[model samples]
Target: MTTRTAEMLMAVVMGLFSVFLMWKSAELEIGWIPDEGPGGGAWPFWLSAIMLLCCVVTLFRWWRRATPESRSTVQFMDKNTRRINYITVGSLVALLVLTHIIGIYFSIFLFLLFYIRFVGRHSWLLTGILSVASPVFLFFFFEAMLKILLPKGYSEPLFYPLYQIIY
Candidate 1:
């Protein structure tokens, strides 16, 4: 399949998976209790249901609008950037594998450093800024504002002080 079609099919599969998750979660008690807040998987279940619906809509629109011309181009992106693409995607895959193993901050830091330094061939200054900034932003956004706890493994305790302060 062409990349566009492959991507869309993957999205459809993801949507179906989300729907299955929502279905499974629905089998559990999902209502808010008196003392406790939302029951298990309230957000994920509902949000994923919404996402599944949206994906259905997207699939419908895509089916209606997609043309043979769109499928003709497999080289939508720059072929010369293959190495950069592989590096970037590899870093992301590694980050996913490492997120629970070493935690978010450390994994993201490593990923950012690799991308900026090796893939992007950027200056140390830019790499330093990005390596420091992105995780901090995500930490505050998820851990502080959303009151969600991410995995804290290996040297993740280093951010405990910041986490306590922000939270």
Candidate 2:
């Protein structure tokens, strides 16, 4: 497909998703309650609202624009670009799926290493640093500051003690 086609399609999909999020968030009540912070749906509601606005603006521009040059001209999806795009996106999706079985932080480390070293052809040193640092940063950020729980998956049993110490 042409680049315009892709962008248009993405706009449509994003708009639809934004609508869905707004609908769902509205059901949960986005407003904050007395003495309580924003409701469960506040973030999704506002974020989706912004997304919807942006999508409308994007679509309007696409609709009004004339030539390909007016937009961010997309170079033809050459073989290399296609391959790299596929590999990177595929790795991300695979990581998401695998996280249910393995864990989030672990999968991130593995995926980053694979994508950088194998797909993007970066150095081993870079891969090693990223693989280790990404998860460590996530552990501190999510667990320590946010106090949010992440899936440990199968690593739960093996890594629970580690989490107790870190978190």
Candidate 3:
């Protein structure tokens, strides 16, 4: 379909999704509690509200043909773009599957390695640095600092030594 059609469709779909999120979040308190800061649903509810507003603005602009994208009749995806989109989606699916089996850290490492080394055609040094550093940073940020344990799957035992150090 044309870019204009695609833009309008995405706006509508996202607007609906935002409304759904707002509804779900509103089931919990969206305002501040006396002892606690923001309520559990505050962030999600406000963010969804903003997203809905943005979607409304986008729809209005599209109706007026106020943006170049709204005016364009160009095809949304050429063959090369379609191929790239498929690859990205496939890679994401693989990441999720691998996360269930191998764990988030290793799966993310593999994902970053493939995307940086192959898809991005970056230098090996840069690729290696990023692939290693990203997972390490995530581990420290989530496990150490935030005290939130991400799924380790089959790789759970491997992190025992590090966990000992942290705890």
Candidate 4:
């Protein structure tokens, strides 16, 4: 489909999704509680409300052809772009599956390695640094500082020593 059509479609879909999010978030208290700074749903509800407003503006602009994207009739996705999108999506699915099998840290490591080195065509030094650093940072932030344990799957035993040190 054309860019204009795609833009309009996405705006409508996202608008609906925003509305859904707002409705769902509203199930929890959205306003401030006396003792608490903000209610559980305050952030999500407000964010969704803002997103809905943006979607409305997008739709209005599209109807008026006010934006360049609204006026453009360019094909939304050529073959190369479609292929890349598919590959990226497939990689993400793989990452999720691997998360269950290996764990979040290792899954993210593999994902970054593949995406950065192969898909992004970055230098090995940059890719290697990011691939290794991301998992380490996440481990410290979530497991050490936050005291929130992430799934380790088969790699659980491997972290015993590190956990002992941290705990």
Error of 4 at 99 (Å): 0.4
lDDT (Cα, tens digit) per residue for candidate 4, span 1-167: 99999999999999999999999999999999998788999999999999999999999999999999999999999889998999999999999999889999999999999999999999999999999999999999999999999988888889999988999
TM-score against native, each model? 0.50, 0.56, 0.60, 0.58
Q: Give Cα distance to truth, residue 27, candidate 2, Å.
A: 14
Ranking by TM-score: 3, 4, 2, 1
With a 3 Å backbone cut-off (N, CA, C), the pairs that clash in candidate 4 are none
lDDT of 3 by residue, 1-167 (tens): 89999999999999999999999999999999998789999999999999999999999999999989999999999889998899899999999999999999999999999999989999999999999999999999999999999998999999999999999
Cα lDDT computed for each candidate against the true fold: 0.79, 0.85, 0.97, 0.96
Residues forming the 10-long window of minimal summed lDDT in candidate 2 = 67-76
lDDT of 3: 0.97
Worst 10 residues of 4 by lDDT: 149-158
Error of 4 at 52 (Å): 16
Task: Kindly indicate the candidate among 1 and 3 with the higher TM-score.
Answer: 3
Best by lDDT: 3
Which segments of candidate 2 are over 4 A away from where they belong?
2-76
Clashing pairs in 2: none
Q: What's the lDDT of the predicted structure labeled candidate 1?
A: 0.79
lDDT of 4: 0.96
| lDDT, residue 125, candidate 4 | 100
Report residue 77 deviation for candidate 3 (angstroms).
Answer: 0.9
